[model samples]
Target: MTGEELGRDEENTAVAGPVDADGSAEIGELIGRLSGDDDLDRETRGRLLGRLARLLGQSARKAGAAGVARGKWLTDLLVAAAPHIPIRDLETLRAHHHGLIGEELADSVVRVASNGTTAVGAAGGALAAVEFVAPPLLLTAPAQLAAETLVIAAIEVKMIAELHAVYQVRVDGTGTARGAAFLTSWARQRGVNPLESGSLTSALGSAAKSALRKRLLKTLGRSMSTMGPFLTGAAAGAALNRAATKKLAEHVRKDLRGGADPIKPLPGGYPSVGPADKP
Candidate 1:
């Protein structure tokens, strides 16, 4: 099927179930907005998160009925949502982080994202004990975990993109190209080295998409480990998420610190968008 036809089907399958809250936005769109939104206060963020949890529950049930978890479905939603994630350019990054440069700026973004994802895990895990007592809530437990998975993924993707900017290793291309590169970076938990061959492909080709789907599945498995009695899920989820984020940050930061400087088209010319499409 063509991209349009496939997307249409995915959209139908994605939104097949009941409305989670007042709005009609899909899971990925919500995640795109929630990722690294500096303006959102805790209360507003909490409300949006509730909506996301309910939506994930609905989507999970619907997809489960159809067949597998639709890993492709989740991957497509996130790729489409990537460009919409609010990432600060270097100037904005410095201003927001109080003129932080180099490692300082990278550290601030990593810490904030790690803390935020840890809190997301805790909130999702808080329902673990009740899930066993209530059948309805039990069904939602996996959904909650799925929601946490996607949100954490979004935050990490945002962090990866921002860290590149902080390190002066710009991935030059259209918004879509850049988004795919960053998404791939997050999927592999590695920094983008523009000098590498096909480092910033126009999109996630078949091999790249498969790798991303697998990574996402692994992270979801980590979320599943949080389900336990006696309210242990919360603690487990928080610790796992914090550690994962920190580890990813360390890996990406190391690669960026050693990678080539800002990307410049070589004589052979790497892939690039036309001038009109430049952001």
Candidate 2:
């Protein structure tokens, strides 16, 4: 090969090397950005999903129809990425909600998270695990909507963590400790009770792993709607996510209290989702 041609090849290799070498970190960053934002516009959201799709494409063109705990891969990634998920503090929550506090603050947090999840679903984002299941054509969907599942989980985890802060439900530990505790709470679909065994671990226990896998599968089920025609997918995915988020928030808010009263969906069920979370 001529020197110029070889030099161009070298330049291209240099550019692509980082992505190939550090895909996991990159994916974690993407998850953080997508989940942390309450106002990710559609174009930006689509671009980010495209990046995620390309990265997942590198691992393998096909995904294994792995047996029970088919969510194992997703769970593993989430545990590793938990520490990196962006969780706002109580001050941020109060600021974001216009000084709302107590049950009012709690209510707004749930609404924001529910709306964020809805934005992810309606963004016309990644085709998700479709690359793993069906023909490799059109948008790249994670195998069984793996991408959406992870992003949605991150949003929920962040919200749950923030909720603890809102209620002054102090989970004593380092950041990683708190992240892990909150992650476990997300997997269990409950709140982290500070008084109970500390609830802090850097890794998932086998039981927690099981619960996470189950949780992931449940989220994945909702994502299946995205496989339908475009509008149908977006609408169904949004509605399902909004409803699920509100339900999970109910469980968590109750879990966070002393003699916590049982919580249920708003009398008529969740309010309709907006184009994005307000502000």
Scored by lDDT, the top model is: 1
Q: What does candidate 2 score on TM?
A: 0.77
lDDT of 1 by residue, 1-279 (tens): 100111122123231233344333566567866776456655566567668878766655665644337477566556655544667777877877888998888899898888878877776666565667687667676666667778888889888888888887766654556666676677777776665544333456666677678888888898885686646887888899999999999888888888523332223322332322233
| Residue 67 displacement (Å), model 2 | 8.2
Judging by TM-score against the true structure, name the best candidate. Answer: 1
Q: Report the C-alpha displacement of residue 147, candidate 1, in angstroms.
A: 0.7
Runs off by more than 4 Å, candidate 1: 1-24, 37-46, 61-67, 197-201, 259-279
Q: How many steric clashes does model 1 contain? A: 0
Model 2: ten consecutive residues of lowest lDDT: 1-10
Least accurate 10 contiguous residues by lDDT in model 1 = 1-10
What is the alpha-carbon lDDT for the whole of candidate 1?
0.67
All candidates' TM-scores?
A: 0.78, 0.77
RMSD of each: 7.4, 12.7
lDDT for each residue of candidate 2 in 1-279, tens digit (9 for 90 to 100): 100100012223111122234477787778778887547777788677667657655542433446323677677666655655666667766777898989998988888899998887876433433333456465455533677788899889888888878887766543444555566678777776554442223334566667777888888788787666646677788888999999988888888875553221122211111121222
